[model samples]
Target: MKVTFPHMGNMSIVIKALLKELNIEFIPPPPITKRTLSLGVQHAPESACLPLKINIGNFLEAAEKGADTVLMAGGIGPCRFGYYNQVQREILNDLGVNLNMIVLEPPDNHIGELLKRLRTLTGSNSWWRVVKAIRFAFAKCEALDDLERAASRIRCRELQRGDVDRVYAQGCQAIDQATTPKEIVQCRDEYLTKMRSLPLDHLKRPIRIGIVGEIYTLLEPSSNGFMEKNLGRLGAEVSRSIYLSEWVNEHLLKGLLPVKGHKLTRKRAQPYLNCMVGGHGQESIGATIEYAQQGYDGVIQVGPLTCMPEIVAQSIMPNVEKDFHIPVLTIYVDEQTGEAGLMTRLEAFVDMLERRKRIQVESGLQG
Candidate 1:
């Protein structure tokens, strides 16, 4: 089966590693572009959330590259994501695109069914071989995430505007090229060292910003208008609420393994939102509170337009801002969102944060 999957930051790297070890033939989708967005917008329902549309775009583009099967993840919450696979499949069918979608559901729900899906996807590969492939891919994911977190912090302080991004890309390339776990670690460490060694302007004191929102939007730069890089370029250090491996550990591995993902995040969100309203609603609330406690200058909540969970979280953010005394920016994106307009909002947010910091300093309060 020639399979393809949606893009979510560095997730494609993990998938490529997994498929390679399984001896599967696959067609990787082209990097997302304006044409991808246009194709999705042209076909998707007018009110569909941004992620589902972009996913359609990814699959359609991959189909053009001769992908006959689509590999997608499944969700279990009230989030509309739980239905994405079915909806996307129907849409493709209506368009007469002859691709089959295989969804890998969360291990916590219907473990037997999940195993069946995995068995089909892996074909006749031994269970042990499958396990090793997954373990190695997870290692790569962790290493990539470490590099990404470091890059976010260092990028804002780099003497050169794009040095951190360039080095981070090189680091990802190195990790992607490595076949073994040991090599993955080596590449990660080597690039991390290179990232640290990059010259920094000590005078540049970056504003610290926490990003929390829908997972797809938060993880996919193209979908969110490259918010992290833009924030870094505007002299802000960025930390996201979720990463792929962390999400897998907390969400997928919890039932199979002794994992308590987002335990503390859930606790912190107890005051404003005690339950999972869907998507990352509770997590977003919790993360915002955590960022405030950590003295972050601001928090940005990004999601697709009409997303229920984020809309719930966004409604409560003004109160969060009042209580925590940290600025919060809520950005909802759709196909219509323009990079220039998004950049303007980011610029204003940064300016407000800098002003707030100066005011605190003048008032003899800790900044």
Candidate 2:
């Protein structure tokens, strides 16, 4: 089976590792670009969210490169994501692209079914082999997340602009090339060392900003207009609430290995949003509260326009700001969102945070 999956940030790296270990022939979709967005927009429904359109675009591109089987994750919440695979299948069929589609539902609810699907695709009924492949994939995902978190910090303090980014790109290439667990660990360590070696302004107190929003848009740079990199360029250290490894742990592993701060996230989110309102709405509220409590200077919420869950979260953010006394910025992006406009707003937000910090310090001195 020649399989393909949509790109969600560095998730492709994890997926590639899994497919390779399973001995599955696969076609990796090209990175999302203007051409991909254009193709997706041309065919998708006018009101579909940005992620769905981009996914359709990715599938179309993969189909062109002879991918006959598609693998997509499924959700079981109030989010519309559970239906994406079905919708995309119909869309591709209408476009005269015949392909096999498999949706891997949350393991909590469909582990047996998921495994059956995997066995079908890989033609391997060996449960042990499948388990080994999954463990390897999860390990790589953790390594990628660690590297990304380190890069975010290094980006803010790097004395030489673009040095961290250059090394990061090279590190990603190294991780992608490495095929075994030991190789992945070595690649991660080598990249971490290089990132640490970069000259940094140790005395500089950079503003820290927490990013929270829909999982897809928040994680995928192309979908969200590369907001994290833009924040770092504007002198803010960015921390995101969602990561592929975290999602796998929470949903697929069913919390067998508890994520640090998972309990605190639910606790902080209790006052404003006590329940999951679908998607990552509850997590966004919880993360913003945690960031505020941790003394972050600001928080930014990003999602596609008209996304129901983020819209729900956005409505509650003003109260969070009032209670926490931390600034919050909400950005809704669609296909037409301009990078220039995004950069301008980010600059304004960072400036506001900087000024607030100065005022607080001055008041402290006066007291």
Candidate 3:
């Protein structure tokens, strides 16, 4: 059975590694584009969030490429994401697509069920082989995150625009091709050194900006209009609140291991929001506070239009800005979100941040 899955930043890399080890043939959905979004928009409910619509488009594209099975992650929360798999499945059935969809839920208290699902997918592959594949794939993901973090740090400092991005892309490509953990480490280090050695404009002081919001929009560039790279190009260093491996380590393995479960972040949010508003809402508030205390110039909260959790976070952000003395910009994206408009807003935000920094320096309030 050929398998397929939605794209979420570097997640496809890990999925590929796993399927290859299991000796399973898989069809990866094509990259996100205008046509992909169009296809999704044509069929999805008008009120559905952008990520869900894009997912439907992804599965349709894969189905066209001869994929018969889809692999998706399941959720349980007040967020609409919890019902996405079932809704999408029903939608596909209505469209007469004969694909079998598999949903992998977090093993919160269902370790035995999770293992049974794994066995079904892996067929007769020994548990040892499956475990080894997961380790290798996870190593690749961790290495990629390191590369991404380095890129974010250096993007605004590079003497030449896009130089850091170019190196970062090459590093990701190398990691994706590396077969062994040693080689993965080599890829990360070799490219990291290269990134550090690139010429930098030391005279330029970049505005420090933290990004906080829904996981899908934060991780998926196409959904967020490539906000991180665009902000860096506008002379801001971007720090994201979430990454793939960290999510898996905390949520996916929570049942199997002892995880802190972002205790510090939750603690920071206690003053403003103490309960789970679902779908990273509390985390977004916590992360913004964390960034403010760290002296960041500003924070941008991005998410899909009509997301209730993000709406709640957005409502509370004015308080965060007032209490922390940091600027906050909320951008809610949909099929109609224009890249030009998004860039314009980012430019204005960065300009304001720079002016604020200048004032602080002149008044002897900042070093």
Candidate 4:
């Protein structure tokens, strides 16, 4: 079966590597293009999240390319992602695609049972073979993660104020075509080297911002008006929390791994959440706390226009803001998102943080 997976920023490259290392024949949908957006916008309901639309476009493109099966991740709780596979699957069926769509649910959902069904796709039978797959997957993740971290630095120059998209495009294309872990490592090094060679140290740091939220809006530039990229242009070092490895670690072992007989983040974040609040709750709180502890100027909660898990986080964020004193901004992105609106809000937020810092410094001197 020729397998394909949906887009999730740079994660697609690593996932594509995982399938290849398994010796599974697979094809990736092309990069996000106006055509992809047009196809998605034409067929999807008007009110769906922008991410869902872009992905439908990705899947439809893959289907048109003769991919017989598509691989996707499943979700839980009140998140609409929990039902995305079902809806998108039916949409493709209505279009006469007759495609075999695979939704790999979280490990707690018994991923092994699903893996058994697709074992032939991996071309591995020995227990050691599965172990090997795990090792290779980790290597791919590490390489891809490092590469994106570097690209994140350069994207500031490329998409922000400087015009280096040609080089950025070269790096992104390198990632898209990377077939081996070693190749990924090379791409990562090249991206970092290119970024460091630029003339960027003259700009002052704006309010340092950390963005965390639903997977789709976080990754899709069109959905958020490239908010993080815009933040970089505003002279902030944008830190986003979502990557292929983090997702794999979350699904595979982070929750199950014991730290003094319980999950570390859950145990550590208890003062924050007494129980499982569900769907990235532990992460959102933990990352904010970490950023606050690390002295980040601010944190921005990004989510889909109607995302529930983020709404849950939003409910408790006041305490985080009160307790940590970190200026927190929430941006709910949708199709109607205007570039001008986002720019204004971000500028205002950054200005507030700068003023707050000055007030604190002046008060300290007076005391």
Candidate 5:
């Protein structure tokens, strides 16, 4: 069986590596480009979330290439995502696409069943092979996460203005060119080292705000124009919530795979998340509260216009901001969103943070 899954930033790299370890044949759908977006726009309903549309397009393209089966992860909750598997199944059936979509359902509390579902995908029962795949997948996840985090720092303060983007592009190319486990690790470190050499703006006790919102606009630099990078460039330390590896190990293997990241495992953030919240945006609300209590300077929530969960969060956010004394900024994105408008809000937000910090310093001095 040839299995496939949708892209969630760099998670595909880890997923592809895991499939290779399991001796499963698979395809990596092309990167999200205009052509991919056009295909989705043509077939998907107008109201469907952006990721849902892109995923449908990805499945259709793969099926046309003679893929017999689709491998997907499933969700559970009031979030629209919980039903995505069922809906996609029906949609593919009506389209007369003869294929089997094997979904690894959410494991709120059941790893055995989840393992069984994964076994169906791999067509193997060997414990050793399972062990190898899990180890390799986790290793790859960590490597991808390291690269992403380093890239964020590099983008924030590229000392050599002109070389900043070039170095970053080369780093991504190096990452994508990697083929083996050792190669992946080496490339991640090499690129990170190269980028760290560049100078960044003086951090200067900048306000650190964690960015949490819809995953697409959060992770995809193209979708959100490197919003974190922009924020850091504007002098705020940006802490992003979603990393490709984090999502895969955290969201994909809550029950099985043995808690990939040891550090984050102690917190058990999934319950408030309620199954990765898919595109629901409820996770942002929880993250806001959590980050505030941890003393974050502020929280920025990015969502596309008309996003339901974010709109819901917006209604309750005033209470969060007032009670916690953490500033909140909600930046909405769409096709029409432009750089100028985003900069205006970002500059204003930074100004507000600076002014408040000044007042605090003055108040402290008075006391």
Candidate 6:
């Protein structure tokens, strides 16, 4: 079966690695662009969330390219993400697209079911081979995450405009090309070294911002108007709470391995939000608290217009702001979101942050 999946930041790269090792044919959807968004907006229900619309667009495009099987992740939460697969399946079927859709649910307590689903894709591949492929793919995933983290740091301070972007583009290409674990490690290190070598202003302490929101909007640059890159270009260091590797470690690997921080996240979120309000709502509150405790300059929350989880998080943010004294900007985005408007809001927020920092410094000096 020629398998296809929707794009979620660097997730496509990891999926490509996994499918390649499984010896399965993969038909990746075209890079997201205006056309993709337009197609999604044109067909999706008026009230559907942004991610669902984009995903529908992705599957439609992939189906046109002869993908017979679609692989989608399933969720178990009050968030609508839990119903995406069934909803999209109905949508595609109504549009007369004939494709086998597989939804891989999180293996919270059903590891065997998850393994069975995986085996269906691998076909005749031996158990050991499947294990090796998974390990290799995860290795690539970790490497990609490391490179991205470095890029965020380098982007703000690079002496040459776009140098970090250029190197990062090349690094993604290099990582995509590497097939072996050793090659992946080598490529990652080389890119890390290159990023470090880029001429940077040693004395420029950039405004540091933490990004927390719904997973899809937080991770997908196109969905969020490339906010991380834009923040860096505007001379701010951006740290996101969600990374694909970390998600995998927490959701998929936690059953097999002992993973930390989930409890800590819940504990930190206790004051403002004590329970899982569905989706990443609790995580958003927890991450914002963590960032505030870590003394970040500000936090930006981005999510689809109707995302319930983020809506819940957004309502609680005012209390978070008051208690933590960290400025928080919540941007609700959708197909109608305009770049110009987003840029203006971002610029004003950055200016405010800079003024706040300067005022604090002056007050300290006077004291």
Reference-based TM-score of each model: 0.96, 0.97, 0.96, 0.84, 0.81, 0.97
For residues 236-290, could you state the per-residue lDDT of candidate 5 as single tens digits? 7677776655565656666344533423422333444433333535567677877
lDDT of 2 by residue, 255-276 (tens): 6555553557867888998887
lDDT of 4 at 324: 89
Error of 6 at 135 (Å): 1.1
Greater lDDT among 1 and 3 belongs to 1
How do the residues 222-329 of candidate 6 rate in per-residue lDDT, one tens digit apiece? 999999899999999889888878787666655454433456776888888888888888888888998999989999988999999899999999999999999999
Q: What lDDT would each prediction earn against the true structure? A: 0.89, 0.88, 0.88, 0.71, 0.71, 0.88
TM-score between candidate 6 and the true structure:
0.97
Which pairs in model 4 have colliding backbones? Answer: none
lDDT of 3 by residue, 1-367 (tens): 9999998998888888888878989999999888889989988999999999999999999999999999998888799998899999999999999889888877767666666677768898998898788778888888888988888877889888889989999999999889888999999999999999999887877889999999999999889999989888888999999878877766665524343356688789888888888898989999999999999999999999999998998998899999999899999999999889999999999999999999988889644
Tell me how far candidate 2 lies from the true structure as C-alpha RMSD in angstroms. Answer: 1.4
Candidate 1 lDDT, 1-367, residue by residue in tens: 8999998899999999989999999998898998888888888888999888888999999999999999998888899999999999999999999898888877655556666788879999998898788888888988999999999887889888899999999999999999999999999999999999999876877789999989999999998999999999899999999988888666655445443367789788889988889899989999999999999999999999999999999999999899999889999998889889999999999999989888877887643
Q: After superposition, how far is residue 258 of candidate 2 from its true place, in Å?
A: 4.6
Q: Candidate 4 regions off by >4 Å?
A: 45-48, 109-114, 123-134, 151-160, 163-169, 175-180, 202-206, 252-269, 362-367
Candidate 1, position 25, lDDT = 95
Flag regions of model 2 displaced more than 4 Å. 108-110, 261-263
Candidate number with the higher TM-score (4 or 5): 4
